[model samples]
Target: MQFSANLGFLWKELSLPDAIRAAKAAGFHAVECHFPYDTPAAEVKAALEETGLKMLGLNTIPGDVAGGEFGLCALPGREVDARAAIDQAVAYAAEIGAGAIHVMAGKAKGVEAQKMFVSKLRYACKQAAPHGITILIEPLNTYDVPGYFMTTSDHAEQIIELVDEPNIKLMFDCYHMQLMQGDLSHAIERLLPKIGHIQFASVPDRGAPDHGEVNYAHIFKVIEGLGYKAPVGAEYKPTGSTEETLDWLKDYL
Candidate 1:
């Protein structure tokens, strides 16, 4: 089982290039980020090349964060905006050679909302496919982002089915799953095929996985047993300094 440091959370103290190098130094097989739009894509690409590590994935731009747009994919009357975001993400992913892009659905619900989400996701999948990039839809727990559209693995699956796009897949985040519900092992087993990538953090508190309520060691074993070859995303916040907390990765390394 390989691992990717989520630079969005893991190495905030460093610039994009330095963060990529730090992740490589820490023995991560690959790296992922939330957003790289602010940093020049060429610079990030250079870092990835220098470190010889793959950039597994990144998130689509969250529209108007201050205006309460965590994601625009599921919002009503935002078709043009949503498509623009998708195009931007695709361009950025291509520039950096990222394999996947997580399309955020923001806080939306109900029948109309679901319909809009399906439409936006379909468009995203179609746009991303030609770039050879996979489109991921994650289910965020209410505890973290109340009213977020995708809140459970089943919810994500339902959306994926409705969208009916080959490029569409789930970004199965263990921290949110543990918060929204339990049964992580069974969920992973059943939803393995739909999952594009997986992320984890401490349950009840988004901290390092080592002290989490979830048994990561056993979970890692199950993932391996289930035959998932993709790198697991370490998308956790450090309880202390990020460097000092890496003792947990000694076994992984």
Candidate 2:
């Protein structure tokens, strides 16, 4: 149960290089990001080299560069755009030595839209395989992303099985799962084999680990018992400063 930090919200506070160092200082083994495509790969790679930190994962197809709401892969009818997005992610992952690409199944419209979305994901997964990167399909809750296509672990699992590829897997986000469905332990137990990545945040509020409803210590223990070796992503907004919020993880670290 190694830990990783998300750099999406930290960019305002730290430079890419400094963020990596800060994450290490705060006791994280790796760092994750939403979109690093805007930054030069050489520069990002240099930062990772200097910090001696690993790139846990990054989103391959983020939506609006400015609004940060849309991702290419689940745009219902934009398969071409989705492929291009996957290509960009593959290039960046190869350059940064990242192991996984977080695939967002954008807003869902209807059954037909979801079908199209799944097809697009399958194509994206195939495109990502040659780059030696695994794709992590995350299920966002309706409370945060109202119409997001992939909104449950079971939904993601269905797509993973349909794709039938070893490189494609689900990103079990504890916060989202807890919000959409309450059986966190059972969901994890059943999906452990197909999960390639995991993320955590307190439920109801998306705050730091100990501030909300989810029992992270027990969740971590369950994950450990299952023998998962991947880094667990800390994708939450601190109620205060990042440092102040991390106190909750002291016992585990």
Candidate 3:
């Protein structure tokens, strides 16, 4: 029942290095992030060294976020930018000793978009494989991200199969799955082999897991039963201070 604090949401107010320290002090076995590119990789590595916490993974930068583009890898005519983003993420992850990267698929649809996504993911896998980093594709819920290229577990699985790279894997986020699809326990069991990492947050409201409609206690038990030894990512927005929201950690365990 080990956990990884998702610095993107848990320690939103701190600098990335300080956030790493905070996660260590809070008893997280490891840490993961959405974006850590802003901080120098040397600084982040030093912090991880000081805290003795493994950096599980980080996401590729979403291109032109201010222009309403959540990601670029799936968008046609953006291969150059998308590959640049992947290169940046892989380099950063290598520098900080992270084991995986979540390659985001922007808002897009239709045949070309899917083709573009598969092509870019192949490139990403090629770039990451030598470094021993896994390429993760996550399915964002359409409710939270309208028209997002990926929205279902089945779709993600198909994309992974299409990519046909051993390094490619799924980033299964429980909150998004609960919104777009239910039957969490069964889905986990079915998708266990392809899953590289697992993340969770409260459903609908996207808050602490303690008050969620999803019974994380049962979910945690299921994960344990499945022999998932990797740290389960705590990717939730705090209902209050991050520290205050940790009662669920002890309760679930």
Alpha-carbon error at 61 in model 1, in Å? 1.3
Q: lDDT (CA) for every model shown?
A: 0.90, 0.81, 0.94
Candidate 1 wrong stretches, greater than 4 Å: none
Ranking by lDDT: 3, 1, 2
Question: Which pairs clash (backbone N, Cα, C closer than 3 Å) in model 2?
Answer: 63-70, 63-71
Report the alpha-carbon TM-score of model 3 versus the true structure: 0.98
Best by lDDT: 3
Best by TM-score: 3
Give the C-alpha lDDT of model 3.
0.94
Q: For model 3, state the Cα shift of residue 148 in Å.
A: 0.3
The total of clashing pairs for model 3 equals: 0
Estimate candidate 2's alpha-carbon lDDT, on a 0 to 1 scale. 0.81
Which of the two candidates, 1 or 2, achieves a greater lDDT against the reference?
1
Quote the positional error of residue 104 for candidate 1 in Å: 0.5
List, residue by residue over 98-161, the lDDT tens digit for candidate 3: 9999999999999999999999999999999999999999999988889899999999999999
